[model samples]
Target: MHDATEATTTPKSDDELKELVSLARLVAYARENARDLNAEFSAYCLDLAFGALIQDLDRSGVSLSHESGQDSSLFGTRH
Candidate 1:
């Protein structure tokens, strides 16, 4: 039910292309690793990606709850 023209259309912007590439990589990784429903594996992959993002943000000096010593939005309180 999908259109061939739509499938062949280019991404609108660099941001869109990056998002697509990231999603494709995630999907490929999931397919290769998560053979079943594998909730634990999925959660591990999500956590790994999130930790990488946090590291990137930290390198860019983009603080979350780290400066305020408060609970993070996703992970809750830090030790």
Candidate 2:
């Protein structure tokens, strides 16, 4: 959930890296909590995360269709 337009003067500093590490730890904690939930709920969360990632890519003008060549359809007409 990072804003694309927000400009940063410098690259990730030591504190920023530390914050990223902390966020990773939190994600790990969430995974552990998910394991305690039902299988359906865990799968739902995984799917939701994937959908969010796809939406973000779309927002950034990343086309996932076969026409873009990055994702090729099995029966798509080739140029």
Candidate 3:
């Protein structure tokens, strides 16, 4: 049986809230696009990996503020 004496709480931080929203969106996208579980899982995993990397950079004082100013192409210049 489940415990009735415990109380539940919602996500308190922006990161936590974003994670929940990302999960919901991922599942919804998978269902709507008929994507395979493997593909969806891979995408979610990659997203988490990149997000953590960026967070770590920020914590280490390596700002990604210039990210938007950099070239978005495959290389320094567009093809």
Candidate 4:
């Protein structure tokens, strides 16, 4: 999990790119498979927005940590 306050202004690493790709794939899958038009459109818009953010982050070289701490309680257990 990323702690926004702990983020640094550094270039995104290969690991970070991989993580973002994974997230994008999940979002894309939802957008492509959703039956409801509203849900599909919402996911499509979200994907577009997220893509823009990624581009901006790449240009700005922002480093966002993808570490998962002992804070699974926020959204229940991962599994």
Top candidate, metric lDDT: 4
Residues 1-79, candidate 2, lDDT per residue (tens digit)? 6565542323455675455444433443454456556566775675465445444434444434323433223212223
The reply for model 3, stretches above 4 Å from the true place, is 1-38, 65-79
Q: What TM-score against the true fold does each predicted structure earn? A: 0.37, 0.40, 0.35, 0.43
Residue pair clashes in candidate 1: none
Whole-structure CA lDDT of model 3: 0.42
Best-to-worst ranking by TM-score: 4, 2, 1, 3
For all candidates in order, the CA lDDT equals: 0.46, 0.44, 0.42, 0.50
Instruction: State model 2's lDDT.
Output: 0.44
- Model 2 regions lying over 4 Å from their true place: 5-10, 42-79
lDDT of 4: 0.50
TM-score winner, 2 or 3: 2
Question: Which is the better candidate, 2 or 4, if ranked by TM-score?
Answer: 4
The segments of candidate 4 whose C-alpha lies over 4 angstroms from its true place after superposition are 1-9, 35-41, 53-79
1 or 3, greater by lDDT: 1
lDDT per residue (tens digit) for residues 19-62 in model 1: 54454345434533553456776767754665554443344344
Error of 3 at 38 (Å): 8.2
For model 2, give the RMSD to the true fold: 11.5
Backbone-clash count (model 4): 2
